[model samples]
Target: MPYGEAMLTIARELVDKIVAHGRADHPDEACGVIAGPVGSDRPERFIPMENAERSPTFYRFDSMEQFRVWREMDDRDEEPVVIYHSHTATEAYPSRTDVSYASEPNAHYVLVSTASEDDVEFRSYRIVEGVITEEPVKIVEAYG
Candidate 1:
């Protein structure tokens, strides 16, 4: 399925980060954020991080930052609206594990695929009650 515009931007940055991290670590997964308001036209921030997991092909984001930003956003009426992850050697689609572990039905799931050898492919999905659905995203210029 094709990703919406909003997701494409997030996916792009995520792919870049993943590839850079993959190269930097040679085998570990790199994690980060695709943060912004809910249903916004563009991503507001890209928070990159070291995949503390140190796995050759896995990513585990530190939630403290997520919580901290979420709380701050809540205070200002903005929110850390999406949880994005990169698939170092997989497609730009959610895996079964992603589906099983998903807890936010109201948020978007952006995936950046670093598997494309020549280029990165990014997409977005919405998981509700274990069912995954692709939504349309509009990639607007960066915004805060």
Candidate 2:
């Protein structure tokens, strides 16, 4: 199924942010979100949330900030498009932790890794209570 165009952009930028944050911390998890409408051609918002700690191989997003963002998006008539996180030393696929936590079927789970920053991989998934079903992501560029 078509996951949508905006998710591709979100996936790309999320990789960049993850790389920058990883370089800054040298070896820590960088977590964030890409909140927008599901089927928009171009994304209208990109909100990055800070990870709670500086660690070697873990990322835990701040729940309070997450709630705040959800509210803000809801006010704008937008849904939680995708929940993104980075794998500092692993590949760009979901781990067991990721699978276990991806309970929202309506949202896409994006995972970026630092294996090759320039060669970033973007995969979309409909995660339902620990079961992940991969979804296809498509990008339609703007003319302007």
Indicate which candidate wins on lDDT. Answer: 2
Q: How does model 1 fare in lDDT?
A: 0.61
Could you tell me the TM-score of candidate 2? 0.73
Stretches of candidate 2 off by over 4 Å are: 1-26, 38-43
Q: How many residue pairs clash in each candidate?
A: 7, 0
RMSD to truth, every model: 4.4, 3.7
| Pairs in clash, predicted candidate 2 | none
Models 1 onward score TM values of 0.69, 0.73
Residues 25-127, candidate 1: write the lDDT tens digits: 5445555554556555345665565566777566666567657766776775554446666777767788888898777655677766666567766567778
In candidate 1, residue 83 scores what lDDT? 65
Q: Pick the candidate with the highest TM-score.
A: 2
Per residue, candidate 2 scores C-alpha lDDT tens digits across 31-87 of 666666655534446677778765656677788988898898888877766676667
